[model samples]
Target: MKLRSYLYIAFTGTLIATTFSCTKLNEEFRGELEEADAGNIDPAALLINAYSSLNTPYQQEQRWVLQEISTDAAMAPTRGGDWDDNGMHRAIHLHTWNADNGYMNNTFVSLGTAIYNATNVLRFNPSNQQIAEARFIRALTMFDMLDLYGVVPIREGESLEDFRIAPEVLQPEAAIDYIVKELNEIITDLPNNGPTAAYVANKNAARTLLMKVYLNKGTFINRQSPTFAAEDMNQVITLANEITNSAKYTLSVAGKYFDNFAPDNDTKSTENIFTLFNKNGERGGNVDRTWNTVAHYNMRPGGWNGWCTLSDYYDKFAEGDERRGIYYDYAADTTSNRSKNFKRQNVGFFAGQQYNWTTNQPLMARNPSTAPLVFTREVTIRTSGATLETAGIRPVKYAFDYAVTGQRNNDWVVFRYADVLLMQAEAMLRGGTGTAAEALDLVNDIRVNRGVTLFTALTLDNLLDERARELYWEGWRRQDLIRFGKFLEAWQEKAADPDPKTLVYPIPSQQIAVNPNLVQNSGY
Candidate 1:
């Protein structure tokens, strides 16, 4: 609930001096930025800045490209020279990346900066409440690091050098235990009103994190043959039950799930448990990168016309389900002059001919033979010359924000109540104490609301698909696939059976260069 950004400067001469003892202060400046007298800065702002760091890796398209593009849920085809960032996009799609990938390095840096900034906040001697929030943020980032890179650089105590100089790198299993312990310690201090105020970290947020951690513990500990231990699954059920018992959230109203991603979603939606508050024109407001990537250039706010989903994923949705919203047919409007914005509501996946707003004419594909801009189900890893502009179905999960000049006001929902319900259901389905009927009911709770038909039974495979249907583009695809053991399976554009090491991304080569303690992931 504390959203004010009171930027203040604080001097930590002791921190700076102590850190410089082992490592040169000018070498990397690992701890505090200031060495001499700097004004006392507000710890709240620092904490908020740590919160803002979520926009960098967690909320952005780069992480999405890495997670989804590497799996069957999505792909980023090399559209000629446009999206081909020196074959990096193709490399991820083809399951052939190494330690030196730029996105990999960038993700590590962003997450590391988040952890470091949170540590700086703690060094300011914040209130117990503030400290709890900072710890939650740090733990969440560390968990992400563990999930993506299999190792987390954990800096403890007041030693700022510990943040840089041979910091302890917790492997996946250790990282999970550390995160679980951190959340359990801070859960009580976190506000119980997260449902009412979705921006700030709350007890419910910590609970959700615990649920996720417990659910993925098997995979974290044993990547090759992840077995859901009974105790761990029970813990997941307990955490999920604690959240559901609170009665703070439920499925969004039918045909209005978009309200969660609407421009005013931060305050408007009750389903969001925790969110990254993104205000238009603010530093973190440009969170609509995914929306911009898929939208056409002819939009009212011109789109980048990049990033789309394969038809195989698109076809997962049942017919007439509101989740699979109507794709307007502009083929009827065939006028010549193409000067205005397109007049079509392409929400879920766009396939047919796209039209111009003013002229009502269908736009031609860039490729001569691939006119009519028809997106097909079949997509190849190499889409340089043969693939046309309409190669894949573009996704618009977050409703296009037409009001803002630069970015939408939709706060990125990091943890929502619907996700809690699904987690609880999954925990039950995996032989937890919760009933199978209850698990099926929870799945139906989300589905029936979205106009999706109620399932007679819930299986692990379809439950995974149901997760994809409900939570795609919001992140979690990679983790979900790994938990279900489907991550290494070959998909359309990616035919190579992924190596076990590919289960977790390689630690950035640049990181190993700077930190001797850090070890590169295997096969890189």
Candidate 2:
């Protein structure tokens, strides 16, 4: 296989020129390649491009916006005229979104592009390791497509000649089976968990994704009322135990829980199972958006002052829970170069009055110039008046990366060991091979590590709240809500949605226009 054979020149001219290492894999290719020069093409570069595709959907706006903003865990309120992008954010939170929603359309296209890129790697004669990695990437993207949209368009065969052919659509049931099969087949070829394994496709990464698939198999099959089969629960438990038994990961201590998301989290984190690799001057997504999305405009980094968690969700954590928030002086800390010039800012949730860390002066809200910048618990979808910019609690999941003016070094987490434990516990509680006492112990283990009180007893509701407290703003809230049967329930700015069709987003209209085989999901 040669580079020119697979490059979709007309459609991916920019991607080929900038992203792929094949310099001549663009419109300039005029069949001038010598047969001997074919050996010069690096298959690893193509694999890296496949891996790079994850940055857009996972780290940046499209998928993260759909996953987080549509749930009770976070919302992008229309603060006067600032974040009101023609009601895109409001439609998501209020469950009034349609197929025309730009976020939904972009997310669908981005995931499809990722899948196409990953599959393109197979057309070239790559090594076994590269083949396994590319297949894993394809499976992961396809899993997301199946979760968000009910159908997945699968390109058949490892032939670029079939690029124009309409892909075979896999419905929910078949999609789940296909993902499970792919992961199982490639798990052994992937690298073992080690220093750099978190950023690459590895055995534990495959195991963690498998655990997610099995635990949510019921939810993926039926979002309205999920049924956890005993066998599927056992699969979840087994996969979690395999990862735990590897001894490569453990929960970060109570004081260092935020380290998992720090700028140098690539080395500092002990709990990350898999993450998207990023560096200051590298080709990666804008992870700084995690903080810039919510921080006050007057803060050290001068954020956009958008999106926040609801008060109802904020009340889930106790006062002493370190996951709630903790003050950290980024300027004083002598750590990575990424934290240079950063003023003091809290790591977790931010509420009440904020201040300039260096000057020790109260920060003022932009709306009311004289009033202090005090974040309040009350917020509305269409915000106005004095509280326009001050309402809603802010969350800073990733530590501030103030050194670089461009892409930050914080590696965006895709799976963490804490989530592994929670999944195991939930599986046990939902009729897996463990007892209720064992499930409670698993939940308490994480609680104790996070400086929170242990529960004397555990229920599904308590487990859901615990997940919210621990995994808030991490982009799993919507899926968790649907799995636990609380997605349609009203909370804060949203009211109960009478239609269950809102559970799965509609297949993007653009997709249906391009691929006639695609049928739009029921509602929209």
TM-score of each: 0.89, 0.91
What are the Cα lDDT values of the candidates?
0.73, 0.80
Pairs in clash, predicted candidate 2: none
**Cand. 1 TM to true fold:** 0.89
Error of 1 at 411 (Å): 0.8
RMSD of each: 4.8, 5.1
List candidate 2 segments past 4 Å from native: 1-40, 158-160, 329-345
Per-residue lDDT tens digits for candidate 1, residues 1-524, read 22533343333332232211234552355434546333476778778777776676766555656777787777777776777888888788777888888889888777776776777778776899999999998988888888888888856664454434456778777788789899999987988774446777899999989899989888887887888887888998888878878888767887667677666666557788888776665545466676777766655345776777877888898887766664322221232221233436545666666665555667655447335656666666556554646677777766655555675666787898888888888989898887889999989988988887899999999899999999877788889998998888877777756468888899887778766778777787
lDDT of 2 at 173: 90
Quantify how close model 2 is to the true structure by its C-alpha RMSD in Å: 5.1
lDDT of 1 at 43: 78
lDDT of 2 at 379: 88
Worst 10 residues of 2 by lDDT: 1-10
